[model samples]
Target chain A: MPDLGLSVLLKGKNMARLLGGLWVALRISLIAVAISLPLGILLGVLMAGKNRVVKAILRVYLEFIRIMPQMVLLFLGFFGTTRAFGWNISAELAAIIVFTLWGTAEMSDLVRGAIISIPRHQYESSQALGLNKRQTYFYIILPQAARRLIPLSINLITRMIKTTSLVLMIGVVEVLKVAQQIIEANRMTSPNAAFGLYLTVFVLYFLACWPISLLARYLEKKWR
Target chain B: MAVKILAETLLSIRHIAKRFGDNTVLDDLSLDVHKGEVIVVVGPSGCGKSTLLRCINALEPIQAGEILLDGEPIKPDGKNITELRQKVGMVFQSYDLFPHLSVLDNIVLAPRKVQKRAKAEAEAEALTLLERVGLKDKAASYPRELSGGQKQRVAIVRALCMHPEMLLFDEVTAALDPEMVREVLDVILKLATQGRTMLIVTHEMQFARAIADRVIFLDGGNILENTPPEIFFTNPQTERARQFLNMFEFAAVKHHAPAED
Candidate 1:
């Protein structure tokens, strides 16, 4: 094994910088997930509700999110809104905002699916027991929906973590951005630096998402 | 006699019509149920027997007509329906016990939450009701853990825990195995002996004959025959009821013929 560009990681403070970058990506995704969970659940319940108007409005919102690409959303959120509205939102802030919005839309759809997936008898039974609408949701609906939501939501977390890599385009200094910088700085010294650096980035992402994916799979099986 | 008549009428359905979209499920149906009376409504599939019970419980809204339980109209909305449902218990054929809850929890959920009873008191009452249903040992078991008859018993206990003025059982044994059907029907028979007012929709003619003080033969969403169980079983008034009872008799004979062989 000649030089496979393994020495690049050994460069002074390079690995530490890459670790910091990974933390940045993790931080953004975690915050986005935290904010999205409750809001998504609320929106999802509304989407699955009886109100035709609310259903139509949320349908349009969901379709809009699903049709548009996330990168375009990032550009629109970070660059378009910043320039048009004249707000001074940081790149990190923009990434968080865009990711949260996307996560919420996706998560809410999952919630709606989970809510409606419950058998109609569940609602009727709860009603027959004289449970009010609120109590029906709190005691009967939510508890059951939650089991379905957990494994799916865990999958969303992994998707969200992977998607956070796109924030590098918006000038957020996450793992991929840091990886690019390291590769660019070592372009002349390490002839195969691009291959190795990109490969390491792949490993980092896999490491980050693997456990979450495993967790999702575990829960899906356990619950089923 | 007038005062007794007025006092005995527990539920009164006055010319009710229920429609699902364009199809009419119950067309201009009227009925009266007395206190401590076990009224069994039997009819062909889609004759609106279950729909009638559902409408009385306010599970389905009536397009036309009024249902009064103890002199108060049971509307499908507002604060009154909750109180109404508390007094009028309905058990489905599917035995819809909450899968997430244990037998005791499923029974006590309404009493503790809606009635605002203490946890200890509600749980104790639930255990007692479970015991009455021969399910005291299974109080801690989840619905999925029990057999069909066991689940149906738990459901009956759940309804009994509410201490309703009456119970509506919509073919409670329809989904059970042949072995399981007897257990559930036995529970209902026990309830009937206690003079618990009930409206039961069932295809089990034997059970209908055994438990019902009055047998209501419904056809085309109309009450064709309303008489004592003896009269209805032996001397049905309508051609439709006579044919319906004959069909059951034929099936019952065929059912036991193989056993005799």
Candidate 2:
């Protein structure tokens, strides 16, 4: 890493710490997406409730997330409500909580749209096949709907990664915030290192997001 | 008249009426199916022919009238509806084969999941059904890879693997290619040879005449005529039936000329 102009950042052991920060960001994102997908499915299905009040509540909740800025959500999670409510939540925990809520809602709506878009006859066929409601969803409808959902879910994971940047506002020391701190510390020694350093952060984001984008396309083709 | 048998009704639909918003379908329709009887419901498109079939299995909720299957009532959210539907397997005009499953899984799914059969036993039964449908070699192939006729045959076997006492065909050949239609008809003819009871909704009069013990003509959501095939084709009772027959004949003739030309 030091052979190129990267040597300045790669001196002694700073590279390892910077990489450790990147790994932490990656770890948070991976856990967030894993937790959010199934949560989203649960919420999306709850939104499909037959009762008017339940449906109305779900609609309000989903629209609330959709309309509000994600940074405001981070603020609400980290600073505004938790302290006021007297809860001792960590910044990392708040960041994860906020992103999970946001990712799950969006993914759930995608699931809802995909499941409902299936020809109504698919459910009728399952009924005719003698499958009970649980069996129908577990076996027929989910398997079919899943084919349409893989790409969308992958896209959601990538969105989760990009949105984690908003967590920097919540004081989560993820990649971008760490990069900003490192550039500030080295501002005197490496005069133009800020742009190059930020470029590394950009590259890290690309490295994380590009493969996911490719995987989404690959899944769409494989399933289609 | 040993085969004349006691007339046992397998299904009794008494004056069922269904509506989709302002569109009234299946208006005051009453019908009965004797055990082991094959009835074909034929009519022009938009006459609610498919909806009537769905009503029998309680796939669509009926606004009025009652349906009794095997002496048990079928009502909305009724406890016994799932078991009744299990006894009634339906094949769609588009084949509706689960594209994801192989021909084998398609057959084995209901038996293993609904009937709670052992996987090994289900596999054995699926193999036999695949052989019966002449799809033994295609068992491992997906529906997308199969021709239309083969897919429909696989669908029939899938329905039969559920061990339904009666099977419903909602124009299974309509989406099939012209060359493939007869291949599917041949499978239907073979099923008839084994005396399997089926209620078919088809536009193919020749298949209807050959297999249906009796044919019921539906038009404007009403039973215009119900009689033996010879009588129904030779002498339709209502003006609507006559008009339907003429149109069907015109369609057949129109379809036949292109092939010849």
Candidate 3:
């Protein structure tokens, strides 16, 4: 018989533990996204530089981050680089560092793409209006380009949240990792509870990403 | 309008040539525009009419020539770009109204930032311009909310708010609806009578003929005719000028003469 009373299965410590895991996941995601924003904007601006030498260097860096899988990057940061550098960092901090780097690179390229996609005439028109370079950017270019960037940026933030689950492989106790621990420990003592704990983790991710996705879509429609 | 102080030659260019990969947009172009002179540049597309206007403001760097505004070359060494931009205002073919900004903010930004006008003063000035352009009711509307003519009107006022020594219009009404075209042209004509020095890049022969103090016909990246509008439009010397004017007339009317401006 199928278990129709799955909601009833979660009670007391089991429920509390599931909630705690979700909070941990949320915290990691929030911190990771926050740390990446300014760095991403700076790098993105650099990638849009007109100078060929500077642009080439930025393209290489941006592409490397984009092409590599997040898992390999996590391993390189936590194990390979940490070993190479002779640093004994904790897995939680390492996971944060890796995710921050990955998220920042992705976010910056999005910003660069949005900004550069602005028509060439917009810059010329602003300049013709007698706005020197800096004034043109602050008054004309940036404000216009920013509208295109916001929805894309929010989408990136949600992706960052979803990708935080991969950090569980680094031994960090994010929501999914915590859920795994609960499942293993309580496996023999109520095997069905293991299934309930994983389902709760899945629901938590859905909750976090749902509003963000909705926000991105809403902004897209509204701005259009 | 007569030259009020003769404006001491507001802008002058000498032997300027521009090329992109051996494709010259302007060749040996030279002209001197006085303050308050309404000079209309008319030509076939790709004859470098817009490029010349852009060069006066340093929007496009010219190769192998020099441009002087008030007898000074605009160079990278000049530090007061905001000040210079405050002195020159340009309206574009696309209107280039900031889509995110309301019709009012589009006018107020350059003044508040570049000209250092107080927000209250800038808005007051902007409101007056909007009123002049008949867009006072559209102050709060975004660029996307306005019709093409209304957007271009806001653009004209946005340029005016900078208090430019001269205004440049790069085919300002070329992109508008037929009914909308006259409204924008009306604003420019009104500005002309009010003594604004302007360089207009246009193909509208009727508007050019009505208001242009000086009209220059550019062909093959060279000025084929430089004379008063009456001379250039009525008595075109070059065969090329006659051919080009015919095309413009054809676009506006079905059975137009080839020799008419």
- Which structure among the candidates has the greatest TM-score? 1
How far off is residue B60 in model 2, in Å?
A: 1.1
TM-score of chain B of 2: 0.92
lDDT tens per residue, model 1, B1-261: 355434489999999998889988888889999899999999888889888988888888898989999999998884689998999898999999998788888999999888899999999988878788888999888888999999999999889888899999999999999999999999999999898999999988888888988999988889999999999999888899988877777864665432210
- Stretches > 4 Å off in candidate 1: A1-4, A210-224, B1-7, B251-261
* Residue pairs with clashing backbones, model 2: A2-A7
The sequence of per-residue lDDT tens digits that candidate 3 reaches over residues B29-65 is 8999898899999997788998888777777778878
True contacts kept of each: 0.68, 0.66, 0.70
- Candidate 1 local Cα displacement, residue A64, angstroms: 1.0
RMSD of each: 3.6, 3.9, 3.6
Two-chain DockQ for model 1: 0.61
Predicted chain A of model 2: TM-score relative to the true chain A? 0.90
What are the Cα lDDT values of the candidates? 0.89, 0.82, 0.81
Model 1, A4-30: lDDT tens per residue? 686898898888988899999999999
Better of 1 and 2 by DockQ: 2
For model 1 chain A, the run of ten residues with the poorest summed lDDT: A215-224
